[model samples]
Target: MVVYLPSLTLFCDSLWTKKMCGAVVLFVFMCLTATTHADHHQPCHSPNMTGLMNVMSLKGDKIAQGTFAYDSMGKKLRFRSNESYPTNTSLGLDLLMLFEEGIFYEIDSKNQSCEKKKLQMLLHPLDIPDDSRFYTTMTAGSASIEGEGLKINIWTGSIPHMKGHYSMSVTMGCLPVSTFYFTETTTLLFSNMEVELEIKDPHLLVVPPFCHGEPVEDTPEGTVNSFLNEFM
Candidate 1:
């Protein structure tokens, strides 16, 4: 079964104005309060072998979009676009090859397949930070992932434009069994604005579908608008 999570978009002519900054500050306070309250309850359970599988798709203010598929067994496949803005012609054309674990596949954008030599590199795992407590922060953006199950969060601002934060949790059941809890916050200033995305699914050591042709460029504007509306 497919579950569609709500998507959000924020449009501001200028995030640097004093009024916008105040609104952002209030939003952050609310998020912190909500998170604090939720933490007091039972911790969220990670996905397991018997849990449901899910696919999560995310689009960020026309800057980036991607999709991830996850099974109960900590395995996942992710595809991310390279374009700064989503394009009707280039939608789903760019891909970032990622494995269930932290391993990255050598992507062949032309053929849309993994290169043999690149797959060989999978003999070893990629070097990723294992610290689960480290939380990256952001504002006015959104992210999603599925490992053992699906986890996603959306924030309200932009990098170098606005300030906000995002949170996520996912479980993977590969070999050792792992779960991830992640959080990130960001503050944008005139000089620089940096947003960090964190994924913290934990399991010991795990070892880890395709629609044909390009996405239709002339997809009706009404359909596209409808899809965007569902998120709003």
Candidate 2:
């Protein structure tokens, strides 16, 4: 005699439900463990870290209008400026500022033909919190300097995610006589986006008096004059 199992369908359905629940529980546990691991290895919140980001952004007018990313372990910094709208001009300039053991290197872009003399001098990284001081200067056909401005202090507890603020002034000049001030604040994001920079008080800058002329290489002055005359 053959016996029929009438409750087989119900038993199979129960087994499928149990397996699905077990898989969901396993996924949840994995996610929790990953989050805990990340929390354990996360960088400690520091006032100096936030300040560094702010100082980098405050350096110049062009610096304010770009996206900045930094790697803490690698000590690598990258910034890219969005091209200005309506003009469709490329404003992207890449700087690989490697900060290794209190030293740095500023790499120039391909389009720009930079001689070694035009490079900026390396300065000590600014120590945040108690002492916020950093010094560096760049000289090309023109010169500009980045340093810690007055009234920089670490502000804490404004945001849970942010560590602190580093305030500083940025100055640029063609000649030492022509200079402008830009106030900035750096916030430590403490996540994939490590830093956030906000320009607190930005002042409209005026270019200093400087010479501008194309070199008359192999072309005579009169030949250039005739070309100008044709345009006129």
What Cα-based lDDT does every candidate model obtain?
Answer: 0.25, 0.24
Distance from true position, residue 145, model 2, in Å? Answer: 41
The superposed Cα distance between candidate 1 and the true structure at residue 1, in angstroms, equals 4.3
Kindly list the per-residue Cα lDDT of model 1 for residues 115-215, writing each as its tens digit.
Answer: 21112111101111232222322222222333322222211211121122222322121111111111133222110011112222322111221222323
Runs in model 2 deviating more than 4 A are: 1-63, 83-92, 101-130, 133-232
Error of 1 at 191 (Å): 26
What TM-score do all the candidates reach, one by one? 0.32, 0.26
Q: lDDT per residue, candidate 2, 109-200, as tens digits?
A: 44333211111222112212223333222222211234312111121111111223322212121101111111133311110122233222
